[model samples]
Target: MGQIDGWEINCDMGEGFGRWKMGPDEELMKHVDVANVACGFHAGDPSTMVRTVRLAKQHGIRVGAHPGMPDLLGFGRRRMAIAPEDMYAAVLYQVGALSGILAAEGMPLNHVKPHGELYFFVQRDAAIRDAVLRAVRTFNVPIYGLPTPQMVADCERVGVELIPEFYTDIDYDSRGALVPVAESVPVSPQMIRDRILMIAITGQARSATGTTVDIPLGMGGFSICIHSDLPGALENAKAARAAVNEVKKGIRISIY
Candidate 1:
């Protein structure tokens, strides 16, 4: 869609298990600018990781590492009570694994985005947040994070390039953390479009509780995240891509 109307499409891919597949990554690769390939912890195996990286390269899509807690059963959606040091080591281990795959394929990791529970943990825990930043800095790559005040400050403090992220398929609390899908958070295409436009136009989202909350929108540089686990994810992605393009053309949403 970037080619269509000057916007980029990004997707979370490579979330498959030993013999269980997840997304139509091979087909979806044709339509995105970036692919956040899962790194074994959450959902992916060695073979799946290599295949995803290779496919991403073949399609000329920017490849990124998507690391999460080691929870195959919960798919990393369940929070783990891990120590900060352990979280740091887990991140480093997963990132290293994915980096090895990318290196072997001659494609470097472009960014790192923690998945599921790890994402939520970092939103509130300073120690875990610092550990994640430290791990990312060790790899010297950009990090994708929710657009929260602490997240921004943490990224800056650690000297890691931060990409403030928005979600098209998930709803957020007044605090900016994603409301768990299990909680039956309802999100619609129009709602998502309106939220994006509001951020583009005013840099805020009216929370479910009707409170206006800041949405960083990168102050001008932001990347939207679309989770493949959502129902009708492909269609939602298409709608989001089109909506962003429309807003950019109609209102000139700046990304600087």
Candidate 2:
């Protein structure tokens, strides 16, 4: 299946582990269309997952799985050597748990988006890509990821719909590779707004060196992501929401 048309912002949710918290998800939910919720492997506990799913339901947002490597202390940001089978099993387990919670809430699993290091691993490791693709086949949902050449071809071959995710709050290098979020510094709210507007209108993002890099954000069925862990994430979402509205009204939107 193809992605839903028009621009959308999918934000990471359910990151808090037990009593520890992360991000302003409650207020931020009002500004996004989909919530990429954390499964147990990364940062969420069972209670956190249930609470996050309920919050998304209240906002009328689509619920998707954000499974990560089993690295809670590291927040799943550390890239480690993992077997393809291990990757597949971790994904299945995490997605299954989230799906169960969604089922209990009378909601559907909207999609699956691998979180943290695993998300970028699809670009680096062929095995990881195949493992993720296999899980998508099992779940029968769209996958959110970067529109790298190999990933695009693999998704086409495997017959899984991939939502090319353009990250509004993350930094990209000159060659358009993502800068690790751990190294990210606080950015001004205006810069964040400008990036969204520019990308929404032109399908290009500014590189760290101030050059325009073409992104594969198509006319429709594409998604822009806002990481909730970013400083002023609520403000970032507000900026994204405004820009998306402007883009929608700027032209005749062709929705799927």
> Pick by lDDT: which candidate is best?
2
TM-score of 2: 0.94
lDDT tens digits by residue: candidate 1, 42-127 = 89999999999989989998878899998999999997789999999999999899999999999878888899888889888999
Best by TM-score: 2
Write down the lDDT of every candidate, Cα atoms only: 0.79, 0.86
RMSD vs true structure, all candidates:
4.1, 3.4
- Per-residue error for 86 in candidate 1, Å, reads 1.3
